[model samples]
Target chain A: AQSVAQPEDQVNVAEGNPLTVKCTYSVSGNPYLFWYVQYPNRGLQFLLKYITGDNLVKGSYGFEAEFNKSQTSFHLKKPSALVSDSALYFCAVRDTDRGSTLGRLYFGRGTQLTVWP
Target chain B: DTAVSQTPKYLVTQMGNDKSIKCEQNLGHDTMYWYKQDSKKFLKIMFSYNNKELIINETVPNRFSPKSPDKAHLNLHINSLELGDSAVYFCASSQDRGQGANVLTFGAGSRLTVL
Candidate 1:
């Protein structure tokens, strides 16, 4: 089974500072990773995805994530964090070997990010 | 326009009652899915439908049945709702060609509260 792990429950960062949200995965085959953000009482919005990509993938709202094959990690990053960027972040993984599990994404426990102004 | 939408943004019902959450996607995507977000914010896929066919059915209870009427609509009906079922249910759609991974567009989510 494919699974994702987000180690931190919460992360605090100051405005204009760089921020990082850690994510790791365990999959039997090649992994397709994604990052999504959710505001209070709102549905999740897609940020970016890493599917056989060039490791570092950029996304909406000045966000980016680096897919590390050796580390089995895909960490979301931002050069400068904004107060509005504070939201719940989720890391999900999908196994390339579809088989019976067709287009099913295994999500992480989510991490709350707070950017102080 | 809302690409993906779910009816009854907030649902409050008593235990043992049955309720249904409706979802529709105007994105013309052939694949639709239902995901449950627990109180702890852990998300799990409950069911998936491709072209109105059940493609992925997770280890969900029989009480929770997902019905896809057409290629764009998928509804979830839960019988004998329990307090543990109180959580936000999200409806998402994607264009999966059975070749590679595709991005999913999610609805605003329906919050279910079983008292």
Candidate 2:
């Protein structure tokens, strides 16, 4: 079974400080990792995805994620945190095997980020 | 313009009743999806339709059926709703499905509450 795990339920950071939300996954084949953000009472917005390129992939709103194949992880990071950046973050993964038939993404439980002013 | 839109942004109904959520996308994408976000905020894929063909169905209850009238619209119908079904439902679409590179366009979402 393919699944995604967000180790932290909540992450707190001060404004202008660096922030990281950890994510690990277990899958049978190569993984296509993605990050999405959900604001209060809103739907999820796509942040970034790791396909088959550089380890570090940059995405919207100055967010970036690093895909570590060895560790089976894709951690989202930002150099500076803002209060508006605080929201629910989710990490998802999909199998990339040529024989893979299930193309749906498995989402993580989600991590709440609270950035203090 | 909203790329993706879902009707009944908020739906409040009693248990055992039936309701339907409508979705439409204007991006001209061929694939659309319906996802359920539980109370714990875990988003799960319920159904996926690509070009009017079912592609991914994740063991969802038969009570919940998805209808895709065209490549741009996918509606979710829930029969005999249960309290546990109360949650946020989201509709999304993508240009195509593959190595997960396609960016999904999502609607604002519909909050379904079963009393």
Candidate 3:
């Protein structure tokens, strides 16, 4: 079975400070990891994904995530936080071994981020 | 234009009533999915369709039925609404089933409130 875990329920950061939302996964095979953001009463917006290659993946809205194979973690990061960046973040994973799942993504309980000015 | 759109952005109905949420994608994707987000912000995939064929059906209740009229349209119909059924339903689509790495485009979401 494949699953994603977001360790934090809420993360608070001051404006201009770096921020991180932690995520880890469990998969039978290689994992395809993704980060998505959701604002108040809105659908999730794709942030970034890590399939293969570079350890660091850059995504929209000046956000990025580092994929650590050894740690089984893909944590969303931002160099400097902005008030607008406050939202709910979710981490999802797809197991490459599960071909029958067919584009099904297993998501974690979202982490709420609050960036204060 | 919205890449993915869902009708009835908000719905409030009494228990025992039946309701449907319609979704459409203009991105020319071959796979579409329905996901439910609970009040605790936990998201779970309910169903998926590839080229209008049911491909993935999670451990969801039989009362929640998903119909894909075409590759671009997927609708969710729920019978006998319950208080526990109140949640946000999201419609999403990806390039194709073969492209597992493709990211999904999601609809704004339909908030359902069952009284």
For residues B1-115, could you state the per-residue lDDT of candidate 3 as single tens digits? 9999999999999999999999999988988999999989899999999999998899999999999989999999999999999999999999854543368889999999999
lDDT agreement with native, every candidate: 0.92, 0.91, 0.92
Q: What is the CA-based DockQ of model 1?
A: 0.67
Each model's TM-score, in the order given?
A: 0.96, 0.95, 0.96
lDDT of 2: 0.91
**lDDT tens digits by residue: candidate 2, B3-100:** 89999999999999999999999988888999999889888889999889998898899999999989989999999999999999999998765543
Deviation in Å, model 1, residue B61 alpha carbon:
0.9
Interface RMSD, one decimal, each candidate: 1.9, 2.4, 2.1
Candidate 2 wrong stretches, greater than 4 Å: A98-102, B97-101
lDDT tens digits, residues A1-117, model 3? 888999999999999999999999999988889999999988999999998899999999999999999999999999999999999999999857856446579899999999999
Model 3 clash pairs are none
Please give, for residues A1-117, the per-residue lDDT of candidate 2 as tens digits. Answer: 889999999999999999999999998888888899999988889999987779999999999999998988899999999999999999988765555433778899999999999
Residue A72 error, candidate 1, Å: 0.4
lDDT of 3 at A92: 94
Better structure of 1 and 2 per TM-score: 1
